[model samples]
Target: MTDAAAPTPSNVVFVGAVATASVLLSAALACATPFAALAALSVIALPRPQALLAVGTAWLLNQIVGFGLLGYPADVVTLGWGLAIGGAALLAVPAADMAGRQAPVARTLAGLLGAFAAYEAALALAALALPGSAGAYAPAVVVRLFLINLATLAAALALRALAETLVHRHARAA
Candidate 1:
């Protein structure tokens, strides 16, 4: 959160708003990998417990939609993928805080790269640790993820700006 956003009470209003925002944004921009953005949004808008709640819920919902409704295959890699996305989102807090202290573009880029890297690293570790992986990190998969990361982060940044603007506007109106 911002420097001025001291830890507020865990009231329902803001928490609900954050949850709704996360769900809507994640669904609307599913292709852009909104998990990272949701995590950063949590750090920016909510406190620690609430951040976890927001990101955790968003991640769960994403999984439900991705595998349940979208017909994604169930497999070991899919399980690992869930953990990776959640990890990326949860790990985005520090990056978001660091980026919050910088200019807008820097902030977004830092959040994007930093959070995605965390995901990539975690996934790599999972692959290394998993029984069937055999240490084979596919080059094509990496390339695809790199592209997804770039696009997702850009969309996330745009979403961040829109959310920040809305927050400011609401504050001003009050």
Candidate 2:
């Protein structure tokens, strides 16, 4: 029988430290912002199902923390905002996937703009129908919200493109 090699103490310590650091870093990054964490998932080239899982997990965690630690009303607002942002992102994915084959820059930009416009239109109509304060029904708010949502959609699309690039590069290298 061959002699079994014993694990070195230094190697064990190094592995432990690395594992701990990774956990801490992941937690910190996820806590930073939903977008950043979602972008990180893209960077890692997670499959669609895995990507959705990450988004859903983060969303649920945010809901719990926002509701339990923060006030209930704030949590409700946060939940609404989270749902809106996530729904927009989800809607953009299909368009982006379809546009990925064409000229990268033009297609990506067009897809993002299209998705943003669609989401903004939906939001605008919903907001218009809501019975609330007149301030909430302001035209300026609608315009600003549209712009912000568009910017966010564009950013997410850009991140997705970058991730696809990295994935391609990795595949070529391998």
Candidate 3:
């Protein structure tokens, strides 16, 4: 009879621990900053639709969790906010992907600005729909959302840069 090799205990334990840590860390970070978490979840590095869908699913799941745990309002409100924010974020993805084609600085800037505006507009519309929301609050919320979008954009850029650097390092090593 041929002998069968048993799985190593250490290997199993290591895999389990890594998986647990990854889940926990992702949940924590997503809750802290949904935008950045979603951006990180994107699979722009992969040139496959399946990868993009998987990444988007992860991002969507994270957003759901955050909305459930955080101070997000009803389902309608959450959905509206998500659609707006997500749509805006999506616009940047194409610009980012096209960055290597030509002079991308201006395009990236424009994309980010457009995204910020879209998010802000959506947020403002949502606020306006809410009962007891003051007219003056619209401006304040717009500013707040703009700032948040900026922060999200910055985080996305930094993460992308880090990912690129790691990829380049790996390529060089190979």
For lDDT, the strongest prediction is: 1
Clashing pairs in model 1? Answer: none
Candidate closer to the true structure by TM-score (higher is better), 1 or 2: 1
Model 2 off-target regions past 4 Å?
Answer: 1-51, 54-86, 128-174
How many clashes (backbone N, Cα, C below 3 Å) per candidate? Answer: 0, 0, 0
> What TM-score should be assigned to candidate 3?
0.49
**What are the models' TM-scores?**
0.60, 0.41, 0.49
Over 101-158, each residue of candidate 1 has an lDDT whose tens digit, in order, gives 6765676567666665665666567666555454335777566656655665556557
Candidate 2: worst-modelled 10 consecutive residues by lDDT: 34-43
TM-score, predicted candidate 1 vs. hidden true structure = 0.60
lDDT measured at residue 66 in model 1 versus the true structure, 0 to 100: 70
Q: In model 1, which regions exceed 4 Å deviation?
A: 1-32, 73-77, 131-147, 156-174
Clash pairs detected, candidate 3: none
Q: Candidate 3's residue-wise lDDT over 1-174, tens digit each?
A: 122223345434433432343344346654233232232223233332432343345445546665665546667755665664455344434433443333445544554555344434544565665443355246675565446545655655676589679989999999
At residue 60, give the lDDT of candidate 2.
54
